[model samples]
Target: MPNPQLGATSLLTLLIFPDVKPDNILVDWELDEQGNQTVKEVALGDFDLSLKLIDNQPLRAPHAVGNVMWRSPEGQSGKGVAKPSDVFSFGLVCIYGLGGGDMLILDAATIKNLKDHGMPAEQEIVVRHFLYFGPLSQGLLNHVADETWHTLFTSAGSIAEEEAIDDPDARFERWPKDIAPHITPEAKDLIIKMTHLDPAERATIDEVLEHPWWSVGVHNG
Candidate 1:
């Protein structure tokens, strides 16, 4: 067998298969590097620059600085329709990489508490939080739960409001507010376009990378 080849930079990309168990999707990735210097099963870039297609859902982790990885389910018809369902999951990834709060952590906490005492709606709220705000952002946790999400959303018509006013030419401007603040106003607008509640309004991976944020960073490589 051929030995694994290393890269010029401390980076490598993996494409996970949808049917593969999340824990087992490591074949395409190299985990032997010292300190795991490269990223593990998570997003590590700012924008969705690479396009990975899988046959099943991928597990997710919360975000931190300097993480940018993204995945999407297969097509839109037949079995592929389920692929789009994975879009929601991938959306959460975008949020995390963008520095959105540890929502899965918060959601798990919320669920455990509810199991001991609250109503079903409490859990629903968190789920909705994921469905709505989970995608398109990695920093919403700081803003949404800041005792100011409502205020900010209302005032800004989503975080992109301010960003849109400034750039006027960004793509994320149309993305839903649920996940916009992690990026700059310009980036925020691009995210807005990606998270448009109407999936039709969202940007495809090909288009997303063409946005300013990715363009500025891509050349650095």
Candidate 2:
């Protein structure tokens, strides 16, 4: 039986529209060699048992050059980590979870190699990011810190100055085709909004929650 605490009142509700609450959103955990478990919830605010309510705040952290796949373009380019960066990571998670994992630029074999061996060269990761996101716009590129811009474009050979042209339409057009036959149109729209190349243009968490994709299976009954 589905747990009512998980936000579904009945089997029908579980099949239709299931609420995703922060109480159920596991942030991190550690498993001991003895099979002990330590879990950490992403609790930013109060959790009221009386109402089963959670007031969550956007999690923030200083940007770090690790986990190339989950890092946003701005993060890779040395921008400070913020809520929008989390949105980008969430988009990647959605893509992977929605049977579009193969759409990413990094192949399974390469990923396995990296995991078994060690971190791939930074330049290799940058190249993969370029292949995944295409070229960045000139305005966005200019906004990136000087050292990061120079490293990605000059040292890493991931981008060229001539490639920095604005073509927002192409960006949106390319992603859907890459992940087609698996993802719904609504999922694609939400992913695009969540993963906008420019952090300022990325959708907020509230917007993501309100997207039509979340309502696709909802029923009035």
Candidate 3:
């Protein structure tokens, strides 16, 4: 299915959306022995499945901030969940759902190598972020708080000579054109903004809802 159709359908079906990850969103379909088929959305618990309302503030799962979830650097560094974080994960889902699997910049072997060399799984995931979505801006780099920043930057620099296409803009320009042919330019633009490395720089859900891709007659009713 085209991502816009899937995204729009999801939004319409789930009145309150949270933790927008692929695993949380399911496709319900079945085929009978007589060849009849049925498909529908199945509700899984409450709208806030992975969230907890504490003192009226929501606390989301920390483990969700990784390869599949697409949290910003600050988020991974413990800034906690916000709407922008959800936007980042939603963009990841949209890109991967719309035939953009090959756009994932890291392969399993690289991840394994990092782990074998003593990088923690969480830090390894962050390193992959830098590899895929960096050379970080000076402002973003300065904002990075922990030792993970130094580790990620040093690892990125070490690979720079071997990785010719290190610029995020360069990679972004080539990504949808090559891997996700089904994605429109406007959709790509939305995804790029939504998945920005800085949470402050990422698009809000309201902005995403207003993006042209959602209203361009490309999605299903």
Q: How close is each model in CA RMSD to the real structure?
A: 13.1, 11.6, 6.0
Clash count, predicted structure 3? 0
The global C-alpha lDDT for each of the candidates, from Candidate 1 onward, is 0.36, 0.51, 0.56
Residues 12-99, model 2: lDDT tens digits: 2112111222232344567789997654333222222112112332222244432555566655654534556656766776666566
lDDT of 1 by residue, 34-61 (tens): 7443332332232332335454332232
Say which prediction, candidate 1 or candidate 3, comes out ahead on TM-score.
3
Which segments of model 1 are wrong by more than 4 Å?
1-87, 103-107, 117-127, 130-182, 217-221
Whose TM-score is greatest here?
Answer: 3
Better of 2 and 3 by TM-score: 3
For each candidate, how many residue pairs have backbone atoms clashing (under 3 Å)? 27, 0, 0
Residue 26, candidate 3: Cα error in Å is 3.0
lDDT of 2: 0.51
C-alpha lDDT of residue 93 in model 2: 66
| Candidates sorted on lDDT, descending | 3, 2, 1
